[model samples]
Target: MGRKKNQAMSVAETDREFVLGAAARLFRQKGFDKTTVKEIAEACGMLPGSLHYRYPSKESILVDLMRLALEQASGSLSEAIKGECDPLEQVRLGINAHLELLVGGSDKVYVLLFEWRSLHGASRQEMIDLRDRYELLWSAMLKSLSSQGLIRADVDRDLLRLIGLGALNWVATWFNEDGRYTVKDIGDFVWAVIKDGVIKR
Candidate 1:
């Protein structure tokens, strides 16, 4: 009726596995409209009652899944760029960190991206706010470049940020580890696109 007893996994580890593996997989496969809390609990090796004790609704699980994705990704990007003074390098590392998380195939993040629209009411608004907060990381990174005059004055920094992130996030849908381009390479290409317009050199 509860989480397994005396397990080697800590609460945080189990939660990560739940979001990254079992619950994420279930949500990704069946979708929020179709997935049940009972199924999620069973997948995580807990009883349905225990799952309810933790998350009253599937939307709550979705909310936490998204919250964790943003938190972890934001933390990683921030740490990756820490103490690096070059705005260009920060942009490179930040974009690379974002792609690495995406292409690493974290099902938790996948559900966050694909199933965010499934959230509703307070849950939806909560996620939107959290997502925007997370986005400020990227916004600030782009703005840093603009302040240094690395980007053109005529370029709409907000538009570039939105389009650049959209393009990078979509990489998860088609990226392959077995492919020629590593995640870093993809980041490089994307940054190059932003830095240099797609004109023939």
Candidate 2:
């Protein structure tokens, strides 16, 4: 009985993953407004009724996808910060983890960034809260580094946050595996700009 129950649980987990993965692809291709429950269900090779058994609506699927992405990103960031002594190393790890999301989970990341606003009421607010909390995590690290006199005093906290997020968020749009600059190269270049200014010394 225990083995049977475990098999059932595994199947349920696999189905949930399937639904989210299909939803992410559809959302990225069509955007939130254009995608429908029927479309997503078809994309997953399931009927609408079957899809409804897993998710109540298209919006719920998108919300679940967003939740999965955020959870993964939070986990990565947490792991990157563990037992790290240097503030700059923390910053580098955090940025690298974030950029890796763009590189590895581009479809989900793109949908999360562009289609998130389509989520309504409680769902929208929940994602917003999670995103804001994530931002605070990065900002806290930056502030700590500045407090230690590691980063320059002239760095504006809000401006730094904006620049960092803006730079990383759009990475999925233009990033190519065959491109001259790899993700690591891009991350390092961005970090150098953040640490040092554009001016020649």
Task: Please list the residue runs of candidate 2 whose C-alpha ends up more than 4 Å from where it truly belongs after superposition.
Answer: 1-11, 198-201
- Go through the candidates in order and give each one's C-alpha lDDT: 0.81, 0.83
Provide the clashing-pair count of each candidate structure.
0, 0
Q: Write the per-residue lDDT of candidate 2 for residues 102-165, one digit (tens) a residue.
A: 7885577778888867889999999998888888888888887878777766668778887888
TM-score, candidate 1, is 0.86
Clashing pairs in 1: none
lDDT of 2: 0.83
Judging by lDDT against the true structure, name the best candidate: 2
Q: What TM-score, over all chains together, does every model reach? A: 0.86, 0.84
lDDT of 2 at 157: 78
Model 1 C-alpha lDDT versus the unseen true structure = 0.81
